[model samples]
Target: MTMGSGGSSIVVPRNFRLLEELERGEKGIGDGTVSYGIDDGDDIYMRSWTGTIIGPHNSVHENRIYQLKLFCDKDYPDKPPSVRFHSRINITCVNHETGVVEPKKFGILAKWQRGYTMEDILVQLKKEMAAPPNRKLVQPPEGTFF
Candidate 1:
């Protein structure tokens, strides 16, 4: 693993960074509300991932489980992954018809940094579900997919 601290600039190679993320995903994150894993075990490049987010409480999305697809291309880490919801949702940041998360509408992906991980995206999305504008928005029927 590459380490950078203070004024130093060190970049972790793609594969090493991806392995670290994979391990963390398997371990489960805080509160167990969001999780992600490799989409295909045979994919040596680890390009695709599946993410799950349980809707936050006290919101229109509450108790709903949302599924998403994330694609980490060759420039991953340096560039944000493409994210799209497989499960239909009605949120300000997500496109209504396509289920894609529009970077222009989502600050996290639009202002992505090299250190951000798939977990960050999932966690942030969960938070978005609780945001004022999205919290009360009417959502599609449960278990419906794009």
Candidate 2:
């Protein structure tokens, strides 16, 4: 189903949620560490979205904006989407090769719930950045791409 058309029953609800997410982002959330939206701006289903997570203050990731991709497939809202990083960094949950966050290692994704929005995932990742093991790890040089 094409996203912009909203003609498919399969994608209708997903598109609605995505639209809500975009609007929520435009209104702005209080946290300075995260933001997200439709990747290309024209897709209504927004199956592919781009998200940014700022490094938590005082943590190794501080001052850095990590780029991420979130893919919500047909089963979305019932199942969590897949996430990958475009920016390089040291994080325990991330796969070094694929850049995909391992659900087994990443609690938020592992424990993802249908009601959770992509925003929730981004914030959870921010928390992970401040998490003990990750917080103290040496950071890669900024602007590094994976």
Candidate closest to the true structure, highest lDDT: 1
- Backbone clash total, candidate 2: 0
How well does each candidate superpose onto the true structure, as a TM-score? 0.95, 0.87
Give candidate 1 regions above 4 Å deviation: 1-7
Model 2, global lDDT: 0.84
Error of 2 at 19 (Å): 1.2
Tens-place lDDT digits, model 2, residues 28-95: 76656698878777665678988899899878998898999999988887788999988987899998
lDDT, candidate 1, 1-146, per-residue tens: 35577667777899999999999999999999899999999999999999999999999988889999999999998999999999999999999999999999999899999999999999999999999999999889998999
Query: lDDT per prediction?
Result: 0.94, 0.84
